[model samples]
Target chain A: MKRGSLYTLAYAAVLGLVCALTLSAVDGFTATRKAANARAEEVRNILTVLGVPVDADAAPQELLRVFEDNVTEEERGTRTFYSYEHSAKGFLRAVRFGGPGLWGRVEGFLCFEEDMRTISAVTFYRQEETPGLGGEISSSAFTDQFEGLSAVGPDGSPGIRVVGDGADDINEVDAISGATMTSDKVEDMLNRTLEEMIGRDGFDG
Target chain B: MARADKQACATCGKGVCDGKGVVTFKDGVWHINPVAVQVLGICSALAVTNRLENSLVMGAALIFVTVGSNLFVSLLRNITPRRIRMIAEVAIIATFVIVFDQVLKAYYWEMSKQLGPYVGLIITNCIVMGRAEAFALSNRPMVSMVDGLANGLGYAAVLAIIGFFRELIGTGGLFGHQLLSEAWYTPNQLAVLAPGAFIALGFLIAIFNAISGANREEGSQR
Candidate 1:
């Protein structure tokens, strides 16, 4: 029985430890900043929904400042301000809107001011839509139209319509040229969210 | 005679390239195809084919990882013990995967986001390991390098074709810009979805299989 020495195991253990430490350090070095960058990216996306110009390259501090000045948060049901520095505000201006998608949950954040009739910014947290088509909803072209779009209907209804071109309503953003289903789904989700915030729901999940 | 060296050994499937420049055109055309022909390295193939830009990034990333992994594994084959070879191969491959991942993040941050987790998933791709053990372990570094390049090209060829269709049809655009006359048909948004990837992949696989079969028949005639 010509058994090899413990050297092989020693070699493997050392090698494994080195790899683990290196990977962990790489992850650690980036994790906090990535998290903060992600948060900033969210803020920037929210600002885009408000139709404000976003420089993703800007410092997160500057981005946060821009977000603070432009889009104040409102509570879910009460339209209470949720801006961080505003100690008296009751809730965050942004609320999460989500529902089932073709692949998984289609969730986005909607940031608004004290008046919930306008959507200051929108950013989807998760979606598995068709990559080029529904996927492009995440694209600037698609999401950009959402800026300046009204959250409430002209009749002062709490919901918005996903309509084709020619809707005279200020709240209506034209449907994506080919992605009608995904477009409708986002519109429907927002409408349901509005309904929930207005106390129309029997219960909030 | 060549027949004498062909004696069946206990490790029959392990009769890898014997470092004698035994690489051939068949390796390129079919035997080691990164996709349907070899049925290897497909997870990333499906995920990153949505946009041409992302697909190209994924392709380049894989090429770098595969070739680097192959070179290192082949170079280290002699010193490695037979028992722990798998671990050795993985360590070598993972090293390259990390470097590839970091380079993408540093240089192509936007494409990296669009690709999502698929960049990391390259580590798990069977073809990279498959080539490492099957060819690289036994072949010289230069030929092993070619094997890696060929396999990557095979995969990229399929991916680019798929990307072209997925981008053009799915978004009514190509490479992130509009190209189609919207009047013909609204973007077949369905094509950009995951199911579209599967459908397109299946057709492309069929087309390749057919061409390969025809080529085989022609060779027999010749």
Candidate 2:
């Protein structure tokens, strides 16, 4: 049947209203759980990078509890540091860092050992890089290279390098083979964060 | 209608006078399978099939969206104005997709992250919209739902097959389990990348066509 303009407009308005209501109901139902999941993920990353042993299967509440009991969140100016005292590694500090990536923002935590200059671990908890190429930044093959490496360069500058070739320097790590732009962006972000971290008043490198 | 169509109609329940449920199911699942037969919705098929779990979840999401949208569209089919029907169908489809995405994010946070925007992209997946337009608009709600379910399953089945091979060959594992020992079998890294999806899908389509072609010839002879 042919429908007039008035009927079509009314039908469209009604359909739009119905969809909006349905979406609003679903959003309301999931808002709490989504927030908890996001919080738990952030806490999980912070704990993992700080070398604090939390169960991989821990629930959001459990992760939050572990994070609260073992870790201290200290705010220094604009930066927030998550510090943990491990039974084995002694003391560790992790800070959140992020920068514009090739596709979107890439964010992660940079953890440091007791000496403040030596790296303990790194985790790219949030990134939107290409799945197999730039996305490898989150994989252990890439992030594991940060362990025991220095955040300071050979010239005493507070920076790290993601080199394409073999990393021979104390602060350099190998870049992902086919992801030069991502690697460079990662390097730039790490250096920017590192500069603020080590060059600041509290840190003595 | 033909005598065979009349006979089929007699067997159907009320409001399903055409007895298209079984036919729709058969068409969606196998005869005109969404992914394998029609080659529709290949983007998610390729993007998520690198892992078995990812493929399954993605498939489930599609199934939910398609079925829900089809049911809603069919229910409103008669009253839906011809001019705004497409817009109405889209609104219903997007609602279901967002609902699935939200629930997935809340309960299965890890899988939600793995699937990423692909789950949200279900709104644009042609299988859901195609069924809503081609079948649901003209069909009863029950048959429309069956069509949705069948197409979703057909798509999911193809995805599972592709995922199974890609994971096993690419990483020498199924669902992240080590089936092929590193000492004996070296994983083909290509199978884990995007190109692997195209290769796997191409092979699957070829195999599907060969079998179906042979079946058609046999039926013709009979």
Instruction: Give the winner by DockQ.
Output: 2
Q: Looking at model 2 chain B, which ten-residue stretch has the lowest summed lDDT?
A: B213-222
Docking class of 1: incorrect
> What tens digits encode model 2's per-residue C-alpha lDDT throughout B107-139?
999999989899989999999999999999987
iRMS (Å) per candidate:
3.0, 0.8
Give me the overall lDDT of model 1. Answer: 0.71
| lDDT by residue for model 1 (A48-136), tens | 54445667577777988888786666554553333432233222256677787656679777765545556656678679887667877
* Residue pairs in collision within model 2: none
Expressed as tens digits, the lDDT of each residue in B1-222 for candidate 1 is 223334533345343444433454356546556696866777778878989888887888878877888887777666566788899889877877776676566555566678878888888889788889988887657668778877777777778888989999898898878998888869986787788889999898878877666334454652
Q: Across residues A1-205, which tens digit of lDDT does each residue of candidate 2 receive?
A: 5668898888888889989998999999999999999999999999999988888889999999999999999999988999999787778999999999999999999999877898889999889899889999999999999999999989998899999889999999999999999999999999898888887777664
Which window of 10 residues has the lowest lDDT sum in candidate 2 chain A?
A196-205
Candidate 2 structure lDDT: 0.90
Candidate 2: which docking quality band?
A: high
Q: Candidate 1 at residue A50, lDDT?
A: 45
Model 1 chain B worst lDDT run, 10 consecutive residues: B1-10
Evaluated at residue A129, the lDDT of candidate 1 is 87
Q: Each candidate's DockQ score against the native complex?
A: 0.16, 0.81
